[model samples]
Target chain A: MTDASNYSLLLDEIAAELDIPPSKYAQAVQRYTSVGEWLCGDDNSDCMDDPDVYPQGSFRLGTIVRPLKDGKESDYDIDLVFEIKKEKYATTSKEIKERVGTRLNNHGTYRRLLKPEGRRCWTLEYSETDDVGFHLDILPAIPKTPRTGAIHITHRSGNGTYEWSTSNPKGYAQWFEAKNITAFITLEKTQKNMLFESNRELFSSVDDVPNQLIKTPLQRTIQILKRHRDQRFANHPSHSSKPISMIITTLAAQLYSNETTTFEALKNIVFKLDAHANLQQHDFILEKSLADQKLILRTPDDKWIIPNPVAPEENFADRWHENNHERAKMFFQWVKWVREDLVDILAKRSVAQLTESIEPFFGERAVKMASSRLPFLTAPGIITLIPTNTPHIEITNPPKPWSK
Target chain B: MKEIVERHFQELVSEFKYLSLVHEEPEIFSIQGNIEFTSSYSEEIIHDSYNITIFIPSDYPNSPPCAQETGGRIHPSFHTHNEGTLCLASNIETVRIFDENRTLMHFVKALLIPYLHQHSYYEKYGKMPFGELSHGAKGIVEYYGEYFNTSNPIITLLLLKIIAEDNYRGHSICPCGSGKKIRICHGEKLLALKKLKPNSFFVYEYAECVFDGLESDSIPTELKSNYIYKKISNKNVWQHRSTTHSPTK
Candidate 1:
């Protein structure tokens, strides 16, 4: 049997290679920082006073992987939340969205790259020389309270009014970060030192470290899963309601127990995720009078909830109830698929065989890149017998048809 | 062999947090533990349960241990017999299911737990959780029928009888209702069974159990005489064995 620890190391190496490089991540931070400055600049102060801008989604969680579209590596969606405060909570949702869009449009460089208004976010697409690029999805919002982490973001409803939608992206990120805090920080330091040693000009000190560059076991597990999901659903664009990154991150975090290796964490998380996806037969009810008692992955109040760890009121699966549980089904299917694939890949003894098996799920390009960077990627080491006075190479058995 | 059993015992302890090994010896293993059998609507803890005498036979795994409950409180009707021996599983069935990897832990979890669960369920619901398999010889026949994918008990008995005699006629019609020659249908299965229980004595022992009610002191010489066989009995042979020998209700 293959040591589970070894397979875990292999997965970590692969995830590290697939992750966005520190240089590219640093560039993203710089761009977002500039946008944050503009959002709070002297000219835009009237729209919202002292607005804050920060990343959300995989970017904030440090689980960003090279996105795939139709089997081709593509742009990463860097989610940024622009939050503001005002004395009166009277500003219409439309005004808040427009104010942020107008600020981006007013900027000379952003005007060319700014996309037409999305339902919630105003996107800015950045061009790149390689296949990989970036799409900055800047969302405008207001906090639920001055100190609380919850926020209400604006979304254009079908009734033609921008309504406030509850979200807690910061809270979710904090919960994810706390899952493997020590490992993440330790890796962050190691990554920074390595970056400094390699290129002293790029990073002068540890504080200059690219925080997003370090990958923890939990983060790597999520990255591998996200990549698998992207490649698996690449062809089914119309059926593109695959499990979202936040739900996956939340569920994986809930199942993670700070396993020392990425492989172990991924294996455990995949299995646990699949286990939860199974609808508990006992939880189902058949009586008509029990109509008010349906709790299929929901609270007793009948709200479909995979509760935000930091805020109980925020249900990440709120949309699932309305979508005929399509997202739930897709999420469970992906969980089972990932579990089976990981089990099959981890059972392979030969490195070449293991790489071959994982390529279908992680993509050939990513697997190849990971294999090249792996320390033991070379062929199995030769076993040399100790030299004797009269050494002889002896054949144990004649090669037969079956043996060949 | 000792190492294998010890390792499996350790695994059983770890896998089931509630279970613990109270005593261990060269030929006997006594496990005393409790488990929370939680179902949909309710959760109940079955406490102070122990199967004291698990007689590990010399030909273990091939022959499973006959576990007997230690406490006298459990009624004989609850999956156990008058001698307090628990019918955890059919030896033939468990061996076939687990094959070469039939370790003590696998047997305990797969078969022993179900037996215990049945008792606990009976205590709660006043009935067996599922239909109980008939005990002793009749149960063995029923089990083999399922294993052979046959529904008729008479066919099972006759097939074993033929295997016991080692007189499988290729020209004889298959007993599986397949309307095929015996050489093709069920031939492989019969050969496999023969390989497992090579001595004809074991097969005859099963045959004797199946036909024990037929005659008081007959060697059961002939099976070709269908007329004689039909005239011998026209009642529930199992019921006539003894009033004490009742089928699992």
Candidate 2:
């Protein structure tokens, strides 16, 4: 086995630099909660006692990375799924979208921030701030039951046809949370105790603990991977169809062995993810006509699918079939890049070499800042050749070969 | 030679705080210690120290010292040879760079430190930072490529094959694709190289990496006589796994 200390140290430094600061996280929490409160209180819409205005996506999974800037703005996408009672299940998609849009438009604070209605969610773009700034994508959804298993929401297909589409954000988030509950709990206890010691008023009891406040190895690994993916594909806007967050989260969770260290977890998850895909191939039923040699992601039973853990009908790999498996190819390419970068970084000794290896994955600024935090580290100095008086070996010829 | 060896040992013990000369003689001297290596500029300790021994041969400055990790905590990527001899540099490189006037400090800082750094790094991480040079023949070809200032491994292989021969007539074409006579082209360099690598086995080993294998006639008489073909075993399930997901696009 390798020493593993340097690897762990480097990952820890990257995580410390990348993870959202507690103050900024709290600000984001306050902003999104305010949006939720405003939607419920507005008399213009039918947002009653508990109109499910909770986070979904990365924030909910506790794998949120500081988003890249868009032009002059550094915007965070805080996806808040707003689900009301299913009393009006037959309501038109347009009507459902407009209802939430109308409520947000009427609110004094939200009126200026409300963006033009999109196909599905109503975007509320917040202005930039010093540390953090984000927009709330309020997806107006109606759940089958109040507990959130399956749901119907507005979706805009090509040719601008708005219609009811199926989704299960709450179920998906709950399933993701369950993937590493034990590790989360252990991390939660340590983090909470630390917070309590610093300030007892921060959290009263364990019951009120917020998941986002604690960072688990699994969570940090996902965040780092996501950030790397974002940077990797920043230039290739066309391949924006790269593997989505849900697929990455699901695959990572499936392969994560709850390794205590972020370095081990990241390495294990990345290596095991491709292997898990290979396992998926073995389990999948083959087509008689089509050769089953290549790496294909599909359901073992019949049709190609990366089924949502919450709602099996919703295939997260929906685009894979149409895109000619470009997504699948790109996913593995990314995994290879991650592995190589990790290996190169850990194997490097000098700070310059370390920075050079990591800059490609985690942006230049992030690497520079993270590497600086390493203790007793000295920058590599330029070497000037000093003439030496060492004696050289006298050149001699070997015995003549058969005179060719 | 004895004065050169003694002087080098003295320089090493003086410069490196953790090192001290243990045994000494006119022909051979041995030194062992905890080598506390630090970065060039920062001078900050890199990591867990290494317990090592340096054995200087009678040839002194003409032949570099044989340094080894005596602690047995060596990483495979460190290129530690049998009996813990550190493969610090290629044989030709050692000969070309070795100088009689260079101090033990010069040798340790230039050769020994880098090797130990690589060992430390490989211990922490499973891979070498700058990829390794394979030992023996393969290594000779690699160094020869750099020594000749040619990036093409094929040409380097050819150069080795040609150099392994005893005579090159003045009118013979150069192996470098230059139509000029060998005497007018690379004759001087080839004559010099004869001192460094006298064997043509390096060319065969290098050829195997570049192509499938060389024909018997294509191999030099020295190499072809001793060449033994080893059968390759079938790939396991992991190799097949790569084929299943091999990037198509």
Candidate 3:
């Protein structure tokens, strides 16, 4: 057909390839559910009352893209919040963290799967097969008072000091869900039918498909942007300063206007972000009209602010002002790269030319997989042009003169 | 209107496969994405694509959708405005084509695709395969001249006056100076033009043609009225008159 369709189709294919496989999703659910049972099951006498384990972050949002490590697709990171129903004043942050770690160590399989404790979570690594696997990071927490779905999780600073950090993963998820509702409603039925058709052995009917499995355009847009970020920052000297997934997800969801396709969603989001980047390069003033709606903001002192929608106090860009605004600089630079690589390249290119241009940005494997599906490449030869016998549209009326 | 827009989007997505609904408002609905096409007559595989955004007004078939090139490949030097608004076809032709088939699909197939094809051909061959019109008021005069099949600007102006006033008289003499009655001469063409657009549209076009002809000294000074002359002297008219077609790239 045309370059517009070809470019978008290729991007869609790449995103589909990057998404977490069905088997892994099922395994992640089973593994985490068992962890929840062990923590609060009746068999364990030391079990706390009403402890719960549930997914958070990208897994909950359905925006998980296969992360990259050293230019190779790596394991999926499944984040779970193992929140215990207790007052924050009941115990110290150290106690809650140790309690969860000790409980996990109590299980034979978990003890074997467990890695060293992280800054905020206990990591459980699963074995890799066919170069694909996933790991679970269980963050030990207790509910924060007054606010629903807000929790105070344990954190260990670089100096090995333990403290409490407030997070509202559940509240954030609810907000994201609200933003995605419009597109979700439009695509849910069609997505369910397709899911059921593909997984006939697992699903009895379209109605049996889980709501969590149906991805809206917002989710797909986030996944695609995350992958672009991953590849853009891979092996860079300032890789640690790359824009985080939280910031990307928050901005994308906030700027989303219920666009019905990933390409449109992404183009609009980046177009606005590029505008902000251009402004940031100059005066960095907050326009009065855009002040309330701006996704990325700046303080009076020129510090970056990308506030968490659910937890207003928690700034997703907390580290953006550090190192002479290195994070902010890189974030804008990445936005520029995205505009050039993904959006601008779609203009005036053939399939082969597009493939070559995207290879360096999205990685060779992903590009190859995406290009392999193109019908143009699959067709035998150039001889397969529109047959002469086929009826073609004719311009019966004379051509008209055009003006501005 | 919403149902119609939704159906149009679905049909577009089914064919283009990449275009997605980008915006939906009470007054406007927009779809943005890439479209791929191959040259019909080319023996070799010549694939090309463009990124476009189409804005369909709520009035829809009554007021045709506007398409813009978002790819940054086309410049104003091509048949587009500086802001990338494509000069797809002359206003009258757009109206006539839409009148024949009042569907977004027909608009894309008949006007949008061919316009894009012309660009592709021009970019490769350094000349527009389909000849182009001049810009601004000059283009309007040229379009009417060609439509009425006459080199004389006065005759074309007279024909437009009849359309603008809705004063077609079959018993009257033809404006072409052929010494024949209007019914047997340009009557069919005039009637067809009358159906394509409202009288106000023709009035604007008639005024535009007069303004251009007066500027070029083709029309006599006696024909210039105080109202027309005063409007033509305005800054907006000068701005419209200043537009010149860029040389072929």
TM-score of chain B of 2: 0.66
Minimal lDDT window, size 10, model 1 chain B: B33-42
lDDT of 2 by residue, B39-132 (tens): 3312323443456778877666656777876544565445666655877776555544444235677666666666665556556666554446
Which number leads on TM-score? 3
User: Of the candidates numbered 2 and 3, which has the greater lDDT value?
Assistant: 3
lDDT of 1 at A216: 79
Model 1 alpha-carbon miss at residue B61, Å: 23
Q: Scored by CA lDDT, what does every candidate get?
A: 0.64, 0.62, 0.76
Q: What is the C-alpha RMSD of each candidate to the true structure, in Å?
A: 16.1, 14.0, 10.9
Write down the DockQ of candidate 1: 0.02
Error of 1 at B130 (Å): 28
Ranking under lDDT, best-scoring first?
3, 1, 2
lDDT of 2 at A317: 71
User: Tens digit of lDDT per residue, candidate 2, span A1-404?
Assistant: 12255446666667656666556667778888888887777564444546767888887777777777541215677788887764554567777777778778788878898887777898888776574567778888877655666678888776877788778777777777787787887788888666556544655766455667677788878887887887777777645766788878887876677888887888777766555344334454444322232223464443356667677666777766455556666777778777767643443323333456677777777777776776433232221112122222121211110000
Return the top candidate by lDDT: 3
The CAPRI class of candidate 1 is: incorrect
Tens-digit lDDT track for model 1 on B1-249? 566666767776554433354445666555543332322212343332332345565666566665665433355666565567775555555454445366766555455555665565566678654445565566666666765778776677667666766667877888777899888988878777766665444444454345542223333333333332333234455346324432111
Off by over 4 Å in 1: A1-3, A88-90, A158-160, A185-191, A198-201, A280-304, A321-324, A378-404, B1-249
TM-score of every model versus the real structure: 0.57, 0.57, 0.66
lDDT of 3 by residue, B1-249 (tens): 777878877776656654667555565688776666654533322356788888886688687777898776776778776556788888887777767877777777677777777777677777665688888877777777888898877777777777776789999998789999999998989999998887767756766667554346444443333443343345564445424411011
lDDT of 3 by residue, A1-404 (tens): 44555566777777777887666777778888888888776455443778877899999999998888889988999999988887878788888888888888989998999999899999998876665777889999998853669899999988978999888889989999999998899999998898888888877888987788888778877888888898888888999999999999999888899876677788888888887775566466656655678578787786888988877777888888898899999999999999988887768554455677778777788878877877573354422332223223344343543766
